[model samples]
Target: MTHSLDPAALDQLFLQARTFNKFTAEPVGDDLLRQLYDLYKWGPTSMNTQPGRVVFVRTEEGKQKLKPALMPNNVDKTMAAPVVAIVALDTAFYEHMPTQFPANPAARDLFASNAGLSTDTATRNSSLQGAYLIMAARALGLAAGPMSGFNPTMVNEAFFPDGRWKANFLINLGWGDPSGNRPRGPRLAFEDGVVLA
Candidate 1:
């Protein structure tokens, strides 16, 4: 058997998965969430140090727990989504560099010695991974709504009591209906946003 796909399908996928503000009543099961994670976790990372940790808040209790962590504006939309994911970073990501970056133990030492530096790197890299997750969901024919409009302190308190993780952002994933989304916002032109130095 031969594999086949239409190149135009990718374009359609991208166009279809706008920032979905509204979702249907359909639920996003754990299996599909795992598939999404599997696809996005393959994205590039510095020294292959995969620091991003995802927690899917799917149950009513989970969503209720998340409410206190969300900003007032985010609570409604978050509660309505089929699945809400808490994207976070593990501060001890460098501890695993022995396996993730076996050739460069020095890189691991750099982060392991400095607590502040470790947190910074983990947060930055995990944010990149979160972006990869959104794109991956789109590629998988799912819609995503990523938001920074949440109380990081509250989220950390509710989710990572031991202080092993830091909140990066929240992503709501599901089948977004057009009725729930607003008109597409304007973007900067290439010349206006790019620097060709």
Candidate 2:
């Protein structure tokens, strides 16, 4: 499906999606979360070799399991958020590359025999997907808090055993409490961060 976003309108969503440190004691509905996932899962991936695997920590038990995995500063806010998503990369993402990258048989063989190549592709593509998920959530009028301070090994052990998934990052989702938002952080200016040829 061909889709396009108006740059100006997209910027508005970017402006709204700020880090939410606090949230109301409200819960996000499972159906809404599912819808969000459905939308995000369709975002582009390298060769369409989708590598993202999301573990939604919604239940009290699941949230409790996440506590031991989060850094001290992130634990309380994570627990309080309506949803904490554990975004992971599937190590075997390329197994289906024959179909996803069918245009070139070489694409299928590219990572088939090399463990390092498979791992690198999965990590990079899943990271890209995670960013798309954040934008999709923002477009849906949801607040997001993206974080990297977490124990990946612990998260994998708690959520995925047998090495099926590798944790990438954690994103808390819910309606924002204006009182919980941090001031917009400074960003590098275009000239400072980007160069045009």
Candidate 3:
């Protein structure tokens, strides 16, 4: 059996982590970005269908392309962030299922034949992978601000012109500026959110 994480570890990963709206001038290097993916990729997905694909927007030109897609409130902070990760889902992720889930070699055929099933699986698994990215970033001492206020169509047209991948959400990554944070909001208690069956 595995032991629970220590309090400090817990705090780093969840207890004290905040969705930062602003970041410091410090840069999040490419090396750190690679490491972040290396850690987050280990997270499980349904049938190991890791549908999440990330595009790190770090260049000025990239930010410019992303600007119009963002909501007005998200523009300034996102532009100022060291890196903005475009978390996306591959529409045809099942193509890789043969290798990823070799034991179920027929999984690819199953997904390919059912568009609705494939779409549902891609969206759900990619969203879970996005959460894993957040936790991994926090564990690595970086702050993440995941946002859903953007125009997904705009983002897809701008970044994923190939049409194989579609945007799910965006996450701004950097060293957080605590002064920019709002007061911590309330969370649903276990009793309020959970049900025993």
Candidate 4:
């Protein structure tokens, strides 16, 4: 069996991690963002259909383009963050299934033949990848503020004008300023939220 992670590792990844509202003035470099993607991409998706796509908006110009799409509450904090990741889903992701799921060359055709199944798989897998992105950022010592308050139409028009990809959510990434953190909230117990077979 795989050994359990140490307490400190657990704390960093889950126990003590916070969804930061503000960040330090320091920038998040391209190298670290690359590393973050490298780490998170290892997470599994059904039939290896990795449908998640991300656009990292770091430049002033890009942020300006994104600004009009954001909700009023999300605008300020997102602008203040070093980088904002627009996590997206590619509806045409199945086109790559032939190579991605090589063991089953028929997979691409399977999804292509059924648009509903293709969309469902793409959405579910991309959402899972967005969660993996946050965990990967935590593992790499960055704080992530994941939010879903933007107008999808506005965001899509601004970022994915061609319409191949759709926004799943957004995450603000940076070195956190602890003073901006809210008091930790409570979670539901397993017994209340989960069911045993």
Over 4 Å off, model 1 = 1-7, 13-16
For candidate 1, the 10 contiguous residues with the lowest summed lDDT are 8-17
Residues 68-131 of candidate 1: C-alpha lDDT, one tens digit per residue: 8788888899999999989999988998898888888698898888988787778878999999
What TM-score does candidate 2 reach?
Answer: 0.90
Q: Any residue pairs clashing in model 4, and if so which?
A: none
Between candidates 1 and 2, the one scoring higher on lDDT is: 1
lDDT minimum window of 10 residues, candidate 2:
8-17
Tens-place lDDT per residue, model 2, 56-108, is 88889999988998899998899999999888999888777788778877876
- In terms of TM-score, how similar is model 1 to the real structure? 0.92
Q: Could you tell me how far off, in angstroms, the CA of residue 101 lies in candidate 1 after the best superposition? A: 1.1
Sort by lDDT, best first: 3, 4, 1, 2
What would the per-residue lDDT of candidate 3 be over residues 1-197, giving only the tens digit for each residue?
Answer: 39999999999998999999999999999999999999999999999999999999999999999999999999999999999999999999999999999999799999999999999999999999999999999999999999999999999999999999999999999999998899999999999999999
Score every model by TM-score. Answer: 0.92, 0.90, 0.98, 0.98
lDDT (CA) for every model shown?
Answer: 0.87, 0.86, 0.96, 0.95
**Model 2 pairs in collision:** none
* Model 3 spans > 4 angstroms off: none
C-alpha RMSD by candidate, in order: 2.8, 2.3, 0.8, 0.8
